[model samples]
Target: MEQAEIQAHQSTYEKEIKDQLDIPLETLWQDAPIEPNWGIKKNSDGKNTFWFWFGFKGHLAVTTKSQYITSRLMTSANLSDSKVATPLLKKVEDQFPEHFTTAILDAGHDYEPIYRQLQGDQMGAVIPYNVRNEPLMP
Candidate 1:
């Protein structure tokens, strides 16, 4: 929500919060309109390519039985895990509502727009939220 919407930029990341603004934004994600960001970072076992680095975010959903990937999405190297996830879930819901009515997402999935859409659509979604931002608890 930095208001960088119009610009054709994507895959924004930094080593430190202090270093956030200085970087030149070299890459663009495969998907446009990426909102929230999520991914784990490790320097390839600390090998330090230094040349290569971006968040690796992917979507893998399974049935309650842990049998198979009900639906999955492998995002471009640099994009928010949450951004890719919501759309995938929405698509699944749209195409096969009978197969998927309720969805459970990790705390990373807690975003205002996604949450609102799920609620508005009357879809069951279990989303874990960050404790500090817990509006429902108090």
Candidate 2:
């Protein structure tokens, strides 16, 4: 009920939380043996409000090179995960444009508008298409 008590409690809480995160913190930055994928976490506290029942979506940018999350964004408590990746990608790109030269993703990131945008840049993406009809390397 007093400022001193609150301050002491806050400091203890902070230290406790930091102490709890040691393993995951180190693991998050470890070098990876394989590429990673972007994710959308479905927050389960929602949909229930509307009688449907779904949670939240957490959009994250993971480093395929390091298997680490470079960045993330928690969408409005009601938005879809798919709806967040694009904006989140833009945010990540704006913050670290140098990190992406050739961005490769699954069919999802191959949106026509996005493809056109990436095409204009030096981004070499392996999007889905009629590769069968395309010329092979000589």
lDDT of each: 0.52, 0.46
lDDT, model 1: 0.52
Candidate with best lDDT:
1
RMSD of each: 10.1, 17.1
Per-residue lDDT over 11-124 for candidate 1, one digit per residue giving the tens place of the 0 to 100 score: 333221222222322221233333434434444345744544454445676777665776666655555555555455555555556675667877767766666656645677
Q: Once model 1 is optimally superposed onto the true structure by TM-score, how far is the C-alpha of residue 7 displaced, in angstroms? A: 5.2
In the range 11-43, model 2's lDDT, one tens digit per residue, is 211222222222232232231112233334433
lDDT of 2 at 107: 44
Alpha-carbon shift of residue 120 in model 1 (angstroms): 4.0
TM-score of each: 0.53, 0.44
- Any runs in candidate 2 off by more than 4 Å, and if so which? 1-53, 76-82, 129-138
